[model samples]
Target: MKRLALSALVALGLLAAAPAAWAHTELIGSDPANGASLPQPPTRLTLTFSEPVPAESATVTVTAPDGTAWTVGEVSASGATLAVPVTPGASPAGQYVVSWQVESLDGDFVSGKTTFTLAGAPPAPPAVTTSAAPATSAPPAATSSSVTPTGTAGPVATTSSTAGAVPAEEGGFPVWGWVVGALVVVAAGVALALRLRGRSG
Candidate 1:
């Protein structure tokens, strides 16, 4: 009977200590530290836990002062530490909130939030754009061309200067005067031949 009682006490002791060994995972510290005011924000965000946790059921969000999310993608968890990416241009000035939730190693879902301050983002340089005034090309120099004519001409009739003048005739006998002069010469020759024959007789 005493041997059974001793075994029962041993079992009881082990059952009591089991809860402490399987404790839930929890956030212990962070890279930015709790409520730290940063002059220059960190390149990567980090979260430390009391025990190892899986990344599948984990979620972390870093919110800026203007309520915009600064985390880029899914967070990575290895061992008891979780690492999150800080988006390149997401960080801004003023107060920021770092909210988180993760499944503990014991399968417990835990969630919490913390805040920090940023000094303000650097001012961006002004953009300067200048157009080239549409490239004044002098409007092609206003070309001028001269063209000469070619080909042959048609026939043209020409007349003498005296064609329109009237023919001048004495006593109005232009054609008949030549015929009368020939007949007078013939009659005088006949009369002289008869006078010569009479003198010889």
Candidate 2:
């Protein structure tokens, strides 16, 4: 009976340690490469992970050196790939940070950041084309104003919470939370079973 009790304690100890063994979703690959220099920004940023990720509740933020966000579009997912559209902008020759938070297959949230640099001077904003119309020629600014953007840009989500509720993207405990809970339940069942067996013996 004493030997069985020691074995039960050892089993419980191992069970408690099991949750620590799991790690969060890792970034397997990325387009334009992490910490790389690019002359021109890519149309889309793609991130591939070790496993397929869910599409909903994923966010990517690309902030320029001047404290301006260049992520002009929404995030889309296809298979293991997560793609975000970036608008054309003059990113000065300096380091830029891209941080992202995503959900893994196990319903756990993971986040990471990478930095990349832009070399060479940014090109001057495109010159305004003039037409034969006197009204068009007089107002270069008016011609620029006529060009309406495709869609209404949505507000960017920042890490802030009000009323004591955690944001979905930034909140949530690690995957180990569920793993630890399950292990604790299993340990309790094993302990009960061992106690019953020892009494019968």
Candidate 3:
């Protein structure tokens, strides 16, 4: 009984520490906005996040409606913003999807997709006009600290619990937990029965 009590206390301590290191990187915001219809294709693609991300290892891919690859330049990060330059070209009026695989500071790989639309065909110039909005947002750009390592897992799964908490990937505790709980109940019942018989005798 003492051993089991100690084990339960140790498990509770582990559960308390789970929340701090169990964060996942996610797409907090984007430029041109998802499903937004712009007058023309933007000069670049910008993705913003809630935390500082590694810039050097991020991969941003922009594909036009016509299935042509429109990413011309490299991905750059200055602060919490990450931007990729778009190739100069005319795109038919339709939706374009931006897909990215970025490495976070915790050495995890994060990836997501967002879409934007062009109201009309792209203009001839690749240069940004005075009337043209900035390709990126005001928060400054973000990037990975080092080159993204290959084979990193995709987005992470997070779970919160005051008791036993296991990641969704490895799966929650197996059927054994229920069996052990049942045994504990039976033991308590036997103990109560002995106490009643002693009182009657």
Candidate 4:
């Protein structure tokens, strides 16, 4: 009778422990599978859990090798799957890390991390070219009106004659005054000869 009672107690204890073990959530699998190497980055990350997780209580973060966050938008929970979007072009060629936390069916929190490496180098950035502006020519200087042309003749200057000045010879005497002196000498000789003839008669 004691053996029968001990067996019943042992069965009840095992049953209670089984439910506690099954109620705990665990990360069973991932889309990029842990320790995976790929030629390119993925657009989204998916995590499979042993039990359904509440979307509001779940958080997933993806970090690049340079320690930059790559995850975007809200974490979505559908049945036993949790998914979050990631930027495809943001990460370079290197190892990436995914860290996640979720509330289990038993109201306990579970957190874990996984890592993956990218296979090749990231695509080279597009070449940048800058065009220089066209050179502008300065305007020509203005020409002055006071300047004379190279092959042209300048103006001639003239002086006006005086009103009452007489025209003189090279000796500084007038030609008309010399002629009148000669006429006066001839008249005096004629008058003296006429007086001598009257005295002889």
* Estimated TM-score for each candidate: 0.53, 0.49, 0.51, 0.53
Which candidate, 1 or 3, would have the higher TM-score against the true structure?
A: 1
Candidate 1: global Cα-lDDT? 0.80
State the C-alpha lDDT per candidate: 0.80, 0.79, 0.80, 0.86
Cα error, candidate 2, residue 175 (Å):
99
Off by over 4 Å in 2: 1-21, 122-201
- Per-residue lDDT of model 4, residues 6-105, tens digit only: 9999999999999777677999999999999988898889999988999899988888888888746688989999988887547678899999999998
* Candidate 1 lDDT over residue span 115-194, tens digit each: 78888666898999887778666667665553433552644444456768766685676666778988998888888999
Q: What's model 4's lDDT at 102?
A: 94
Error of 1 at 19 (Å): 3.3
| Candidate 2 per-residue C-alpha lDDT over 56-117 given as tens digits, one digit per residue, 9 for 90 to 100 | 78888888888788855888888888988888576677788888889876678999988888
TM-score of 2: 0.49
Per-residue accuracy of model 3 over 1-201 as CA lDDT, tens digit each: 999999999999889977655776778889978889888678977899867787788888878888887746877887878987888476888888888888876788989999988886545888765786768758957853444456866544444476776534355666777789999999999999999999999
Poorest stretch of ten by lDDT in candidate 4? 143-152
| Candidate 3 ranges beyond 4 A from true positions | 1-14, 121-201
Q: Model 1, poorest ten-residue lDDT window?
A: 146-155
